[model samples]
Target: MRGEFAHLGDLPEKQVCHECIGEKYLSGQIEVEGIPATCDYCAEIETPCLSIVEIAGRVQTAIEQHYSMTPDGPDDYQSAWLRDKESDYNWEREGEPVQGVVAELLCAADCIAADILELLSDRFDCRRPGDPDEGETEFAHTSFYELKAHSHRDWDRKWQRLEVALKNEVRFFNQEVLDVLKSVFNNLHQMQFRTLDVAVVQVGPSTALEALYRAREFQSSLDLKKALESPVGELGPPPGKYARAGRMNASGISVFYGSEQAHSALSEIRPVVGSNVVVAKFSIIRPLHLLDLRALKTISFKGSLFDPSYAEEKQRIGFLSTLTDRLTVPVMPGEQEREYLTTQAVADYLAGMSEPELDGILFPSVQDGKGVNVVLFHKAALVEPLAKTGRKVVSASIEDIDYEFDVRHPEYEINTETIEELGGSVPMLPLFFDFDAHLESLRQPEHREPSLRLELESIEVHDIKAVVLQTTVLPVRVTPQRQHRAGHTESGEPKF
Candidate 1:
């Protein structure tokens, strides 16, 4: 999931897609070689076990009518059984199966995505009174049931802005918000609404939103609803999702396929793995409502090179900086690059230059497919010192695993309760998820302390948290310059 081909390492440069020459596809696999122009989802030939994920979409109509009218509502429940399979890992985790592979990847699979799209199309058609857009595929997956396929990328961009606002509101009314969230977690099991991995809600104005939780556990969703019935005190309806049935457990690293050109997503992956969140998938694009930075850190990424057709600009050289600490993005290893800068030549060049904050060296690691083999050698010079001093250099070596089981337990549903709770009546803009910030919160718990950090940011959401990444960036310091002020200026400048 890195960017398009640059060609410097063991792997060959990737071939540009026929339809979109700028957007390159993989040319080599660890064992499987020569990838065709087919899309990854469509290309996977082996039939994988299908896992269905149905979450609550937007409920525009009244709850009673909405609930009663929808044919496939709760009462028309289809049993989601966990079958024993010969897959590598047991999805149910109960025990071993003999022949079939347990479903592991939920939404990543094309089959599952296609099936869910079909199911959503039906739900929205009935949920909304006059919405003909219900049958559309992209609409079914959007946070609000109206996003079109061509507009998805734009919708995502708009969503990030909304995410920031929802988080910002946390500073205003947190405890009351936490109470509602806690209620969702406490009664989720009893409500018989067990497996929800993803939930979507609308962002707008709502004077009064009444929802109920009906099950053996809680008497009504309104049981706790009355606690904040008054709009004066209900400062929340925080624009994004609040919590999940078990989101923290499932959160992990996700490097999106397209958004690599502008932003290099080398997100830290400590929070999900460190704190132990069950992952929804390898990458969480538009994951649960909130900006789960902890989960974002576990991922790394690079943007796809644009279609060569769009790359009309000529004579432009792009350079990618350091990747991971262990990575070494070597130059193209052919004799040509070697001749340009011999070891002696490079040494002579360096000797003439002053030691200006030498963090590490850059070297080419591999040349796979048509993609560039750009890698960074973080702390390259420090390795020898630490090794000589008997200190350890920590790194995780990547090894390919044959994934077989499909993740099916927790499913992403269109959560109406969450939407109405978030204040959709009064149209609120979408939000951008700050996953990196969330991961950082895990490190400095003090920053996310509801009372402390929330007070500063006015964030009072229950379980106010973040993942804090503590990396040693060499901050070069110098003595502060003295400001000369008289009747001059407030900044200590001399006023003439």
Candidate 2:
């Protein structure tokens, strides 16, 4: 391989797809196997590096303290991973037992966590790293470690052990460790063994930029002393540390977090876009700090634009004085999204607008930017395909997939999810501060200061009403011209 080495001089500078720009798992290609290829990202996404480094340093200091006095173990979170490595090596590496010592300390720190798991396995194999490659199976690495838990009680016990192990394993303590532990805990605490069958939930890069923008808008010149005055509500740390799951693309949400890692990420083209920015939106759609909303400068909505009340509730229980302009939105549709416009077709038909004009057309009620406006498509507006692909059961899990709705759906459209169906998973939906709905009613074009008396839940509770509309003025009067739309059928299309 040394003889076949190729420096930067040997390869043509391959370009990443335009859409892959500003990603943590960046684009830009290298000659692998002597061929150029365009593929998906190959690196884990980024977050606050300084914060991670700080936490790691803290762990090391804590370990030293415990080692000096007595062999106290690591945090259960940390021990589960590192303890075994300690047990396995237990001796020196590279003429020094530091790696082994680190492992032992990890086990000691998480002794309590190990007690909780109390799992033991009969299969313990001591082999070099090359003996256990992950290419064999999805659960190969997991099963290899878990096989030691033969004496474990149940699935829960094994999972708990897994958590500790992930945390303890020094290698797992990296960014990848954070990602894995978060996933493992979420699954254990929420679905148990269930899969997310409804929504293709993912965080995108755009989410990061939007969040930073919000933080910038909120903090014009407020100092940290002034911002953290309140733990949550009108003043605080800010919710920009979380994931926003709006109808926006997954990349948007991910970029939001990646941007936080460093100012010089290849995925982020904008520098110093915003600092210490806080964001609050309709839902915790992506990921963010989950400690408490009261600690951050955040706000959320209860319903959508179609609720006939979003604009009215802009100021109730929210940090309004810190408000800034909404961020610029890209016009391209999201990945795996299929929806039609509600009124753009009518506008195009009458005005004979071009495709770009049609795509940019706003609804009648919101064209003026007078109030809160969300894009809602009328079934007639979209060009539906003639042949059906597959059945999508939206109504099946309406309440369960609400985070997606808070991100994408028209605010008024009931997402058709239910808490009861979730079994025991905590729903990650936004809280609709009710007073905001009534607050704007006071302005009614006459600054009347409407009575802010109702609970937020009472504002726009659309308790699943089934209705059928019948209109005598049919579409039979219209005739189509030949174009890209000829393949569409005359019949109506069903959209989610």
Per-model TM against the reference: 0.14, 0.14
Per residue, candidate 1 scores C-alpha lDDT tens digits across 208-247 of 1111000011123242232122211122111113211111
**Whole-model Cα lDDT of every candidate shown, in order:** 0.23, 0.25
Worst 10 residues of 1 by lDDT: 314-323
Residue-level lDDT tens digits of model 2 in 438-484: 65334233422111111112112122223233347756677764443
Q: Candidate 2: misplaced stretches above 4 Å?
A: 1-219, 223-226, 234-496
RMSD of each: 34.9, 31.8
- Off-target runs (Cα >4 Å) in candidate 1 are 1-50, 54-113, 123-496
RMSD of 2: 31.8
